[model samples]
Target: MERLRRRLPPLTALVVFEAAARLQSFTLAAQEMCITQAAVSRQIRQLEEHLGNPLFIRNHRSVALTTAGQRLFGAVDESLERIAQASTEIRGDASDAVTIAATICMSTYWLMPRLDAFQQEHPNVALRLFALDREVDLRAENVDMAITCGSEGQRHGVRMAHLMDEELVPLCSPAYLAGRVLREPGELLGERLLNLDREHWRGFNWAVVDWAAWFDHMQVRGTLPAARLAFNNHAQQIQATLDGRGIALGSPRMLADLLASGRLVEVLPQRLNTRRGYYLAINEHSTRPRAVAELQGWLERVSHAAMA
Candidate 1:
């Protein structure tokens, strides 16, 4: 075995070669390996020189694996995958973390507080959260589940569970209402509105769920109050509204605690019953791994309790 090891190709070169062959692009393999394309080509050249056989047939656009390269690629790909699977299986129980991709606001306001409870119950099951406002494809991103906003299941074969259908209403700090006679939804048009600009922004595209839509829902129509302030993210808007900067259209799901604690108050009695709601979507397109199932179950329970 020691003598056989001396005859084996360099593992580093093999790794680069496998990536280049599998992806069919040296540049892509380089990107995946966090190295330059030249580095990938150099490694491949070194491997080919050692083997005394050309591995890849380079062309104008991209490179393709030669017959010998294809045979080697098949073996290396399987070997690497097996190694990874074995490693994962061995470490699965001790460090089985559930990767949950959620909205920035939900992660901050909802998940952060409830995460302790989940951890307490499932001490062994580690939790990994990708808190962002961008859309995440569970399959592409390798996330177990995503907390998403939608009316129905967005992806075929993906399992969807209702998380929260929170009432959309105007929110403001109690200080914002000092010396002001607030009556109804229409009255808020005169107030300094903290808007979530969806027209031009990065992150949550909830512009349709704004004051204009709220007004339409309330059966009141008029020119919207000029946004005294606006934030790209609702989490930021929630914070600004909490500080008494202005009135922001907020959700009971995100601001329920604040609303209950008197840190923030709804400006209008009327709330928008939106068709759009937050959902727990799992990549049931494939096998539902136990670790994913464990976290999903806990999340459903937590969500049910919160919305209850």
Candidate 2:
């Protein structure tokens, strides 16, 4: 092992190189590996230096593998696949459960309500759910499935299916509306608006529609009103909106039940559709498991029905 370690470049760098070569884009590789593009470049550079040979021809917008890169990629890809298969066989079905990872907001507002139906349909399949609010690596965490929200370009190298596009609209409890009329977007300037604390999510790079962006989209020119309240978590912000604290920009997919039950109502008729949406991401290593496949199919059917 020591001799092999000295003869080879870092295993992590090899993995990163394989992703970059396979995807043909550092940006895409970074997204797939859950790292920064610069980090991917750095790892590739280190591997190249160790081998004393250039592996990639870097162009302005894309990268192409050199002959040496092609050879190394073939070897590394096969070795990794074998390792993954061996690991799976060794682990076997000792812990048989379809483990799913998702954002806290997604788990609470979107997924939790539908779980009972899944249980009823597949009674013998045990399930484990992890509600995380930060970025998670499906491979590293050994998650069978993940509910991810992002732009199309950002999601690559995974068997994914479209769930729903992000649709945002101003929402408030009926109590806050209280026989008042809000016809124009400008009228919202007079009401208390709930928002997410930008400082709290500084690292997450959350690009959700804020009051300023919503106003710009509506062509309401002027200084935007300050937020009446702000919370670090989306779930908290949603709870405040439900409590009639203020109107909030809400996603119908997340608040479908509330809107249907009349607990939350759209303040204005306008809805903003962004290019981003939710998706079901299946782990590449776990695709062969029967339970994983069943859950994936269920999610697709359920999401499609909801979107319809």
Candidate 3:
């Protein structure tokens, strides 16, 4: 072991090389390592001398990784990342933030309003919310858990616990319906309808429920009205509704705060159950199951209250 250690290049030299290879600039590596640029250059030269091979090809104003540098970088970068993760785990701070991947609508309308109370109750348990429309790979993204909107079998390799089944109901801001009345479900045909394009999604075999199904379920026949507005997702759809853009189909459980605050109103009592639902997907490597489980429980309570 001693002989092998003596034969190997210095660990510091490898560290310097890793940074330089990643940044592709001695100056940037120096800034990252809090050392002079000359020091980084010297370390790289020493490493090359030890290995009998050049790792970087230095030009007048730029540096590029040599074939050898690329080979070493792939391993070194992965090793350093693993080391950092291990260090974090060893520290084991109770206040370490757990990351949650939330959908656009869920993050904006449903989860945001309830987050403050969760923080207040568990001050030591920190939280981080990643809001994006696309479904994320939990393990690859280093996310602890996710709030997904789809059927139970949409995602694989992760266990899901149903938070709430999304019920489609038409909603509009009070201003949008001013001087207009909705005596029945069909009365909304005269109002400007906000529709989302589900054509791209129709290509996938996922159980995506849309407006046409809802209209058919309500028994409202052909040639109702043209869409006055269109949106890509429920988040923007709800915002447009709030801004009086048009009447949008929304989940009552998710839009309860707006309804209670009088920012939005339900168009009619008729609501359709969609194939989609909100589920909590737990990562296989997640260490903070208790924190995520608490959040799941809180959501169940909130959804029930909203429906009530």
RMSD of each: 6.9, 4.6, 9.7
lDDT of 1 by residue, 152-228 (tens): 54564368888888678888899988857688777877878888777655444343477888888778878886777
Quote the lDDT for 222 in model 2: 80
On residues 147-186, what C-alpha lDDT tens digit does candidate 3 reach at each position?
Answer: 8877777443367887888888988999988867787777
Write out the backbone clash pairs for model 1.
Answer: none
Q: How far in Å is the alpha carbon of 85 misplaced in model 2?
A: 3.9
**Who is ahead in lDDT, 2 or 3?**
2
Best by TM-score: 2
Candidate 2: TM-score? Answer: 0.78
lDDT tens readout by residue for model 2, 14-45: 99998998789999999988999999999999
Candidate 2 local Cα displacement, residue 164, angstroms: 0.8
Clashing pairs in 3: none
User: All candidates' TM-scores?
Assistant: 0.67, 0.78, 0.67
Per-candidate local distance difference test: 0.79, 0.83, 0.80
**Model 1, clash count?**
0
Error of 1 at 306 (Å): 3.2
